[model samples]
Target: MSGSRLGPEWVPGPDGLLSRHAARVILLDPSGRVLLVRGHDADEPERSWWFTVGGGLEPGESPRAAAVRETAEETGLELRPEQLEGPVLTRSAIFDFFRVTCRQEEQFFLARLAGGTATELSDAGWTAGEREVLDEMRWWDVAELEAELAGGAVVYPSNLPALVRSLLTGWDGSCAHLGEVEE
Candidate 1:
């Protein structure tokens, strides 16, 4: 993987819309806070949203590999593949970015960063384009996140807080499809 290439590949799907397979991780700290990225459409800054720390899988890259790579790239926290737990949850959604609409299939993993805190992140790891759309990155506890959602801020995988809670309880090693996020 080259550092210069982290964007999504928009391929046409059966419904005739562009599609992409992506990997996302719910990065947790010791306090149970999950890291989230805040950003907006590059062409429309007002259309902001918050999402987990991961991105598009490179061609032929396994989901775990993409998770590790994307976690490192997006959060500057390099993690070994084995450290990531159950993909726990999978979500499908159709969203727009840079004026192109895409059907995104994403898998979510659970990874813990012992003693890690939000301050460890810096702008140095982001791509120029990422920095442009991304306003900030922060660690959010479920209540804080839920408030944001209720307050009208967008967070992908609408059931995120519930999903994270499920991860906390423990998984039997089975990945569940969370169904679609109706656009």
Candidate 2:
């Protein structure tokens, strides 16, 4: 058999999957642009895509806490857990990575910032693994994202423009289930 497999390394938990939970942020600038990170699979660099900022939760960490921590680590912006609103969107996905096909459940929080809240996200803060795989981070307007989608570029969490528009109108403070997404 090949050394690689399309499943998580760990044994399936009671949930019947090697479940992983992630906390992501929909960070918005004053002008309402959303932040997206450009990254690629370490083993497949050509398969580049843009996605929100987040990672798997650490032991005993709540999703909100993880969101605040990850935002600071990935963007160099420190924010309180209270400042983040909603698990606005939740998504489930199954994909192959790091030699495994893993099931991931993600919770997305909305955090609006002033015109210049994010500082330069230099190499100083990136985890070694992230530094190797994450190419760049950008703030994108809805039109730009729509154009990319129309042009057949891959964007994660599926309906990105609709989601951002919902946030723009106002968050109802209820978690919306976004269902499954393909990676």
Candidate 3:
């Protein structure tokens, strides 16, 4: 496969897919609600989905640092790298966005809102590209999220509800690989 650059993090990988590594945050609030973002395909605006807060890691940044940075950029929730808990979950996903097929290896970290119940988020930190596709951000109770998923709303990490439920109970100090997800 040819290794060509689409951007700093995205490189062409096997089968011609753009590949990258990302850090995701399964950020929870004091009440146990998880923060998720709603975004649409840049090439197909009608296709949208809800996903956890995250993005590709910048050059030389560790997953923990990227998790903290992505969370802040996507939700205005600033967190220190040390505050991010176990990359509790890891998974590889292939999806289409902005008309490109991408294979992303993602690590999911758990974090709790420090000292408030407030869910208000500022979009001031979003990048120009993020602003083009990301439209909504909100906190969801696991039950409500499950209801939406059951009702057919599209969500990434298709098993998100279950994962959130498990993480809520507490991490076992082991990282779980979720295998590969294609969409």
Candidate 4:
């Protein structure tokens, strides 16, 4: 798979990259805070509330490609991933992926954007405190995310806080020890 190149199909073009449909949550690390989108162009108050840049898989497109695309469209960031844990979200019990047995499992991939911008934010930026739409674009510490989980505040479909935490932990060490860096 060394000299191969993948097309937009699940057939593993030439590079040998896996062909799986997935979603990506782009976490922008600024000086000490992380960047997040509110709502789309139509939601209430309405745009980038407590969310990150993301979208569904496109035909033939890999999850990493999707992640890069989303960060550009959503945050206008023109950066690539530092690394990631490929995730599959499905009802196929988490234990199933381990070789057990399960029903269904949807898949998702996550990446973090370090330095880059959209040139024009659709109301984009960072969060230090809280806002009406987001309670604020907070560069939350790992504890905050854990707290949200403990309190059960992740009610948004597109907002996968726990999953995000998991990916971050996979990349770094612990979500609780994650450092908030801003650009």
Return the TM-score for each candidate structure: 0.88, 0.87, 0.93, 0.43
lDDT string for model 2 (14-92, tens) is 6565657889999888888888998888887788889898887877889999999898888887889888999898988
The candidate that wins on lDDT is: 3
Give the candidate order by descending TM-score. Answer: 3, 1, 2, 4
Could you give candidate 3's per-residue lDDT for residues 26-65 as a string of tens digits?
9999888998999997778999999999999898999999
- lDDT by candidate, in order shown: 0.81, 0.80, 0.87, 0.41
Specify the poorest-scoring 10-residue window by lDDT in model 3.
1-10
For candidate 1, the lDDT comes to 0.81
Model 2 quality (TM-score): 0.87
State which candidate has the highest TM-score: 3
Error of 1 at 52 (Å): 0.3
**Per-prediction RMSD in angstroms?**
3.4, 3.3, 2.3, 12.7
Off by over 4 Å in 2: 1-11, 14-17, 116-119
Task: Show where candidate 3 strays beyond 4 Å.
Answer: 1-6
Off by over 4 Å in 4: 1-22, 26-35, 40-49, 88-106, 113-138, 146-183
> Which residue pairs in candidate 2 have backbone atoms (N, alpha carbon, C) closer than 3 angstroms, thus clashing?
6-101, 7-101
